[model samples]
Target: MNSDAAISCPPDVLDGSRALRLACETLDIEADALRAMSQRLDGAFSAVVQRILQLSGRVVVMGMGKSGHVGRKVAATLASTGTPAFFVHPAEASHGDLGMVTAGDLVLALSNSGETDELTGVLPAIKRQGIPLVAMTGGLQSTLAKHADWVLDTRVEREACPLNLAPTASTTAQLAMGDALAVALLDARGFGAEDFARSHPGGALGRRLLTHVRDVMRSGKDLPRVQPEASCVDLMREMSAKGLGCSAIVDAAGTLQGIFTDGDLRRCVEAGVDLRARSAADVMHPRPRTIAADMLAVAAARLMEEYGITSVLVVDAQQHLQGVVHIRDLMRAKVI
Candidate 1:
């Protein structure tokens, strides 16, 4: 007989079995804790946000072990969302990193027991600097809470671990609460795309937030342009030189009157038009979709998507051709 057939399901996999029993235990404990957290929300959470907002200096987040990991993320979220903040290891603060926290700064400390020795070790120095302490802890009576300027009680019934040792649900709750606080502050500060762009000017979100059509649009040597009076043969030369497969046909005053693309050229050839003698204005599509130079690349994307066009002319309010933005360029940059 095969071992796979011979072996039965583990005791944990059956009804009212080990896994079922433990899952019940975990759910009961965590569910109650989560529910309690909802009821526990009061003035303290507000006070923390208020204090951080009022502070003239940065917010220093500190913790140890798993809490330390959560603290780093909390600090990052806060910093990127308009509030200036950074994480500091509690142990390092006991050494020399304490210098990072200034008298005007606000400190948000994380510890499940509310009595992390490393954190408590630097409390005296923080007190000396007169820095405000906002403690996140499960134990209200813990030393850290007692010494805190504001205490957020995150009391939990038990750990999700079978041995009731490892932090699972507690840390999840802490991270969730931290995110809530950061987003709330972000909203309150009137934080918009531009404010977010400054914090994250290197990624796709940054590009979406900061990049404008003029910044990425093809111009000067790369611009596909021809005079309206130019022959189709001459317009093709401009297209070939720029490799844009299209050229803007501008009037004597430099106002965009039409666009001549490869598609238009193909149609003209199919119609047996005399390409050598026909001027650009006679052959080009009139009134092509145009975008303003100051418009966001994202807005350009919206206009392109709505019009189902591959290219848009970047022009000023006065309709002077500033440059051209192509769908291929936006795609290559992953701006769409």
Candidate 2:
């Protein structure tokens, strides 16, 4: 046969209806697996959570092949949700990485067959070290399950793959079980958004909850402020010098009397008022939108959006002008 003829074949004809039907079938299979797993959860799941809570060390997850991929994601989910955990490839564990596991640490081994050679090879060592093992596998009577202190049955009736040879539904069941464990542990530990934020300082939730107005606000010399009796020229100069687009009108005692922004200046100009003759207090908007310095930066962003303004003054309990936060500051900090 000619090499080109042997390698070439007609493109498979597209069948939109069949494709959609297969996709729906796959989802239905996986959804059914999850529902069955949820129904099968018993005291064993809760015992695992309770044991992990009392553990002083972290959860070390191990697996091979497709199970390894799922294990990595499960480890990440657990770590981010306030459970301390990490993934260790089972093959690597046999190659001296088992030293990473300590007495207090718990092992969460994943293998669809529960007899993966690389994973099972380390069981004896883990047992000798007296480290508790929790097997997440479809194999109930396999070596991994036999050696485990607790067995989480992640078995599925069938794969979502058309040939029923792939790890689709089984891996989904394992991942869902991992998430269930993390959520249960999170609730038992009373882990809240703040705790989750600390673990994900680079994420959106962290930026919103951990970042405060004081952390992003302009203070001291950077804050634009003019005394109540200062001329409008002085106020404009202060605003321009600080580049905050607004100036706070403060009294002699550093109390925030009012705020003057570019809008206020535009109104003054449109009214044909002599800015040079006016004091900061005369052109300022009193009782301006203010936020406490301790408030979350996202809250400051919300105030700016709600009032259709670009800047807000940060004040203390006694209404003393502490700082100024511009919309740009919130954007730069990614709080918006």
Candidate 3:
């Protein structure tokens, strides 16, 4: 829908598509504001980055209302990305959280108007602590900007809201800018995906990066295995007993020769084979999916999916059998 149709539509009522288009327009305005901020990033931005780099303590982000919410998210992102940071409500900081701030910590104050009474109220205390302050705001003359050791200019011409009252484009700009800052600091600090995973230990990326196949793969008495010279009937029994739906076929020396799965069993049954007489090698896939025991669980899961299999055999460089990984294991462990 076009802007004219959107405007003519009722205040409280409009078609879903028109509303979605308006929302997209608001996002576009914010995206443009972020672009403007990026273009303005020069030596001043570098100076702010240097100051943050020198901090020995956490980045205490503080703000009110929407800015406070944005500050919380920014702090979380910074923490997970290698910068030690946390959000402290300026009002609450006045009460007791101010103690969390020490002389070594740096402050990132967020205020759209740059004159929030609650945030401004803490300036004296922040000053007394001798902690450096970095201001994110629209007004250069605001109390926050005036006192900031490093001020990041977030000024915007106007908001995307038609009423010019809601914080639409401004908040979006703040979020995008905050992300840029965190990412820059991340790069400067040499924070990699593994470092991020360490910070977000319970999140999916953490599980993927830190979890190994050995942590999730079936081993020892739980592993399913059969010999190449063994009968298919007995191997099927092993698969059923282990509940792995598959069994690795090893040579006399315990080297992986092949893999026998339910799919292989189906093919054997269709081929009219005498299950009791057929050897494991006769029905097994000679080159089955295999991975290293020390490989990441996520990589093992990907190999299984790419091959459309339910289990992967763990082996050494010489194909010595070690263990087995079941698709269900990855699912249960939440590695997939």
Q: TM-score: which candidate is best? A: 2
Give the alpha carbon lDDT tens digit for every residue of 1-336 in model 2: 888987696457878898899999999999999999888888999999999999999999999999999999999999998888999998999998999999899999999899999999999999999999999999999999999999999999999999999999999999999999999999999999999999999999999999999999999999899898998778888989998788998899999999999898888889999988889888899989999999999999999899999998999999999999999999999988
**Model 1, which residues run further than 4 Å from truth?**
1-32, 272-277
Best by lDDT: 2
Pairs in clash, predicted candidate 1? none
lDDT (tens digit, per residue) of candidate 1 on 178-295:
8878988998899998888888898789888788887779988788888888988899889999887899988878788999999888898899988887898899999799989888
RMSD of each: 4.6, 2.3, 4.7
Query: In model 2, which runs have C-alpha deviations exceeding 4 angstroms?
Result: 1-12, 269-276
TM-score of every model versus the real structure: 0.88, 0.93, 0.87
* Reference-based TM-score, model 3: 0.87
Candidates in descending lDDT order: 2, 3, 1
Q: Which stretches of candidate 3 lie over 4 Å from their true place?
A: 1-25, 251-253, 281-283
Model 3, total clashes: 0
User: What is the per-residue lDDT of model 3 for residues 1-336, given as tens digits with 9 covering 90 to 100?
Assistant: 999999787777558997899889887887788888878776767887788889888899998999999999999988888888999998898899899998778999999889999999999889877888889898889888998888888877778997778887778878887898998999999999999888888999999999999899888889888888888778988999999888998888989888888888888789888888878888888998899989999989899879898888999899998899888899898898
Tell me how far the alpha carbon of residue 19 in candidate 3 is from the true structure, in angstroms, after superposition.
Answer: 5.2
